[model samples]
Target chain A: MTEKSAQRRPGGRTARNRENVLRATAEVLLHEGYEHLTVARVAAAAQVAETTVYRRWPSKAHLAADALSELARTDNPIPDTGTLEGDLRALLGQILALIERPEVRRVILTVVSLATDDDEVVAAKVAFWESRFVGAAAIVIRAVERGELAPESDPYELIEDLVAPTYFRLLVTGRPLDDRLVDRSVELALSRQGICAAPVPGRPASPSADD
Target chain B: MTEKSAQRRPGGRTARNRENVLRATAEVLLHEGYEHLTVARVAAAAQVAETTVYRRWPSKAHLAADALSELARTDNPIPDTGTLEGDLRALLGQILALIERPEVRRVILTVVSLATDDDEVVAAKVAFWESRFVGAAAIVIRAVERGELAPESDPYELIEDLVAPTYFRLLVTGRPLDDRLVDRSVELALSRQGICAAPVPGRPASPSADD
Candidate 1:
């Protein structure tokens, strides 16, 4: 529904069917959780044959991953508020909003559960995360480009460091995520680039370099 | 068999019985995953009556949670290596090692899966994590006492920030956890308190405060 998904691949009817099927897939995922999702059910909901769903996504994991990825790509916004901090805060806010959604939580929990055992699902999970970080990474990219951050700062890794804690808290520690949490995260990451005051240690001023 | 679990609770025979049953519970959890784990199977494996296992720990989640909590309490080391960085690196290394273990991974994944839908399991998971963090919290406490950090800094939250990324990588991104990752995490955290040099910001010295 966002856009470009219909134009992402070649072929007309085939692409349209996939879009419709994936939409139905999302509905089922939200309504029933991943445990009850099936190609048959998806096909029935999409008003297509079981063979059609099977021909595209061999497993439910594949279908679910595809559907979620499409939705995120087409709908998820890339915040550009000029300042890196503003952009990151907006991005984290969006993520927090998404995680608080029961349907989103179900999809995430299901994918994570599958990612534990299945190699295909693991790959999908990795790709899904890598792509999701695109918007976040752009903030870091602009900061680096404008000399707001060090030239040596790795954008992808920096985004991971900034956001990984939120995921960690959500999935493992069960801590509440808030705007303050997001701000502190961005601050900690910014500290690495000398954007804030660094606290002292029981040593000489300079830090020793390591490879 | 860490010490004190034998002496922590009630009657001598009862304590011994619970410990043995919990040990058996762990064995079943490791060998078969949680799907096949039951009080009857654990009782048979422990050479105790099924009624006894049920009498002590009503649910498998309860039993498993108790076992893991006890083990963490007794076995999880409280690192005091003079420096905050030393403690953090040592703690994160220990966590990375634990996460890499097959049995550990299985236990965590199974518990996390159950925690998704089961309220009791969610409570267990929360208790299990809070207790596991006690050791890590100690490290942060020592750092604050040693003048390495601010007095008002929350030790538990700091430890959560330090360890969350490792869990995120293990459970979600499927990225490899290594010494470099550990070192970067420690460095980033240290940067927060000005223990390391705060890199310069391009715009202003002061970060804007938010309500």
Candidate 2:
């Protein structure tokens, strides 16, 4: 339980403590929000000393950022559906589900607001987004390997295009997300890469045909 | 000067006081940020009584929302270029310029954070977005009328696709915005509506050709 020993060890009891701390952090953020989240409170909830939490995360922003990033990592797994369209649809669905939660939305908006003033939060935000993009890029890479997408296609841009609208609805316009928007977002993203999803068996080939 | 008289007068001095109050609100928000913005500060800055500001805006959140919304109104105008492509490009350019300002970004994030809990701020935010969409819809309506886009093209959807990536970069990813993103966004949006911008006289036809 010594501070020096804890810092030196990254496995066994130390690893358990880290997991417990992160879990407590998420619980505090989700239930109590960013304003109520503090190193002291998290340590108390995690059954760790204040020094332990401070030795690990320097500030409340860092703690919150890590908690949210860990939430994203664990909550949403990359889809490996056979086709790019199916995979993208599934991935978008996962994102939609995660962001739609009231607590998650509150945490996200608070993080965004904190990032405006805190450089530590900004760095954490950038790292969190970079990791998400890296994970999502697997879908595009698989599509290219299967000859379903151009090899030169930028996975980052494609992923951004696919998810931006949903996030836009969540954060910007306050518009509701729906099945139609999700389907269209997938279609538009694929079309940008010159890969169109085949029309559903009985549906019109061209969107305009419906008119 | 009397409270009753000010409420009764909608023109002349009342209008001037309204303009001055809004201008002072913008100044306080831009220079001092949302945390430092207060009715008293704004009233003192505008050379009006605090009652004047409180009579119009009941809360700090409402004052901030209205000031930011008014700023958006005066800063970005609707584009009326002859073609959808031209108009979208112009409109996006205007949007990019406005949002790129640090102060504007700060105000937007602050307002978004406030809207999570405050109903008045939420109403103002919704109204602000609706008006912007209404103004931007002119581009889509014009294009549909001129046979450049399909008759059934939804202006809101098209506009959402066109601008979501830029806002995503600003709010989520913390990525830098550039010309390539702007151009690609415009192209992707139009292509979804079955409208493609013509290649420049000497440029390649297909985007892949550039590779």
Candidate 3:
């Protein structure tokens, strides 16, 4: 397991080349937007030969998906603050921050357009989102276990409700994504699911928690 | 305002020219997408001089906004089924069908990207959404008048709550927008806003109406 031995290991060069190319792809996409993106620029940025770029990725769309898959692999950090309300806001705020990035916004539009035409891209994106939902579901599961949320609560739907308005405003309605919108989104998602009946955090509770 | 006089009116030719150009813009976008879309092609399809297209719209983005403005103006026909639930489904169904169109989806993605970069596009898009919201708000206002929703209900938020998830799934997550999702969205919007307590259609109620 020495450095030289590791470098000579099978698939090591391939993995390293992938890392460099994908990193370059993201940098070009972020700074230049999608239209300015080209295989030549990416190859130059990565310091890899154009053939190496083509050998790994058949198309720019595939290259973009590789970068997005990397993004989707980033763990959805679940904030632990002892209440479902705080947890949702922290998780949602994290999402707000991610989507608010100008580069990510540009990247997402490209991904969405690709998803529309290509089945493989659609499947990959759906799987990516499903995985993210599983991560976010941790907060809801903890609440349900703590007797804050109903046992029947569907976490995917809950997360979708909390997150959808922001995406809608971002892509469709062109509304501002601000703190007020976030607060209302959290409120609506919780209250609609009947989790709003939970007693206030410092209040004394009766024997019947349902009330 | 007879038909012949209307056609002979001062703005009539201008109106006809606009229709031709906008239709041409949409055809090119649907057939070729945003990349091949150029003023020359649009002018050729529109049967107008290229200078005419330039005089009317400064850029391809401007031409796109004008076409999108037309789509947004098609009134969101508020369905008048008796129940608020029925009305929501109808509105949501209409939205689902529109977004499902390949052409509309392409147009929307282009418009969203343009809005991000151009001030004029942003203003035009924001105004268009505002108008659509105002039209959809009619359903909420009717429900309030029928004593189903609270009088203080903000229609825009309510509509946004139901519609955002659909757009999010379509453009961001690439999830299916089906009947189940529509039902859940409607239920969540109503329950969260405390509008789920209304009496049944045939139920007799006290004059006080607080029961």
- Cand. 1 Cα-lDDT: 0.72
- Which number leads on TM-score? 2
lDDT of each residue in B86-198, candidate 3, tens digit only: 99888888888887787777776666655367776676677667767787788888998898875556778888888888888777887778889888888877786663332
Tens-place lDDT per residue, model 3, A1-211, is 3544454563666668778888888787777776777889888988889987886666776676666666655624777778888888888788788887877887776666553677656665666677677777788889898988888888888888888888788877778898767766777677776755333344322111222
List, for all models, the DockQ compared with the true complex: 0.29, 0.42, 0.31
Docking class of 3: acceptable
DockQ of candidate 3 against the true complex? 0.31
Tell how far residue A121 is off in model 3, in angstroms. Answer: 2.5
Worst 10 residues of 1 chain B by lDDT: B202-211
User: What docking class should model 1 receive?
Assistant: acceptable
Give the runs in model 2 whose Cα sits over 4 Å from its true position: A1-11, A40-62, A195-211, B1-11, B38-63, B198-211
The worst-scoring run of ten residues by lDDT in candidate 1 chain A lies at: A202-211
Residue lDDT tens for model 1, A38-66: 89888988889999888767678778878
Q: Which scores greater on lDDT, model 1 or model 3?
A: 3
lDDT of 2 by residue, A50-144 (tens): 99888888777777777777788889888999899999999999988987788888888877667556687787788778878898889988997
TM-score of each: 0.82, 0.83, 0.74
Candidate with more favorable, higher DockQ: 2 or 3: 2
Off by over 4 Å in 3: A1-25, A33-66, A69-76, A197-211, B1-66, B72-76, B195-211
